[model samples]
Target: MRIAFLLALLAGGVYYTYVAFIDLNFLTRTGRLGPGFFPRSVGVMIVLLTIWALVDALKEGREAATNAGLWRDVAMLMVLAIIYAVALRVFGGFVATVLYLAVTLSVLNRGRPLQNALLSILVPVAVYLLFDRVLNASMPPGLIDILPI
Candidate 1:
């Protein structure tokens, strides 16, 4: 099952990388960064990491699948990611990221509320600053427009 999951991730990453490379330009007309820049980078990283994980899983063989708790954790994280993606549409980048990180950290990093809270707020702020201020790129706006961030 672990191998299967890794294989699926590798396949998805490959497809994402293919689309990023084929459908999007790496640079704008003026030679500045384009829309495809981040996606292409991310897609490449995903493909590489997934391939590494798949290789590791194949080496582990049947022994890795014996841990039901590990599978549960993987499933939970996947579900959280899906929720975060949906939340990005509804709450936009900053608020959705804050909420998603808070909930996800609470579940995955139990007994560390202080760390979780700090990360939940700080990471999103940093990302917002990186994209909106430093990069001069637009963040995804929410449908509801709750925070005015």
Candidate 2:
């Protein structure tokens, strides 16, 4: 499973690297810093991290056993992320992210309502402020737009 996780990460890293290369045009149109600069940097980082993860997995395979169900956790996280993506466009970032965090934490930590609620609300609000205010990025308004906040 660890090997599988490493392989998946490596594959994703490679795919993103390819995408970053293709997206270079978007970055080159502007000044020295292009739109692809950040994404390419991220791709490079992912590639390095995936390589490191693969090495660690190989070393651990030879050493003591490690049964953390890393793949299962990853799968669950992916599903939650997909849910959040779909919900974000339809339900808005706040609602989608809250639901995603709530569901993911509940599944992972066995449904602690107080903890889940806190995480769900706090994380989305923080992200909203960061992206909307700090980064000046646009996000879907969703149903919440009806209510004046």
Candidate 3:
């Protein structure tokens, strides 16, 4: 099971790396890297780590499957990610990010609603400020683009 999961992750990482290389536009070079820079870097890292993890898990034998828990949380998280991708364009980065962050935090920190709520609000806002103000990177401002941003 662990091997299977690792293989699945490796496949996903490879697909994303392919997408990164192909889809994103290269900004005319200035001081900063192109739009694909971060995604390409992350894709490579994901592929490398997934490969390492798969190799390590295979070497450790099949005992991992017996010790591992059910796939409920994993399934739920995957569902959430799918929803987030759909919501991202319609709701824009801030709203989509906040919603995704809140839900993920709620799921991961089940007993701490207060922490989840606070982080849901704080994290996205901080990220927005850092990226938009400091880094000068634009986020998808979808729908009511004028207000929150």
- RMSD, one per candidate, in order: 9.9, 8.2, 9.8
| Backbone atom clashes (below 3 Å) for every candidate | 0, 2, 0
lDDT of 2: 0.79
lDDT of 1: 0.92
TM-score of candidate 2 to 2 decimals: 0.48
lDDT of 2 by residue, 25-128 (tens): 44455456776788888998999988988888898776456556986788779988888888877778777777888888889888588988798899989998
lDDT of each: 0.92, 0.79, 0.85
lDDT string, candidate 1, 1-149, tens digits: 67778888889999999999999999999999998999999999999988888788777767523578987999999999999999999999999999999999999999999999999999999999999999999888899899997
Best by TM-score: 1
**Predicted structure with the largest lDDT when compared to the true one:** 1
Q: Which ranges of candidate 1 are over 4 A from the true structure? A: 1-65
- In candidate 2, position 58 carries an lDDT of 90
Instruction: State which candidate, 1 or 2, has the greater TM-score.
Output: 1
RMSD of 1: 9.9
Better of 2 and 3 by TM-score: 3
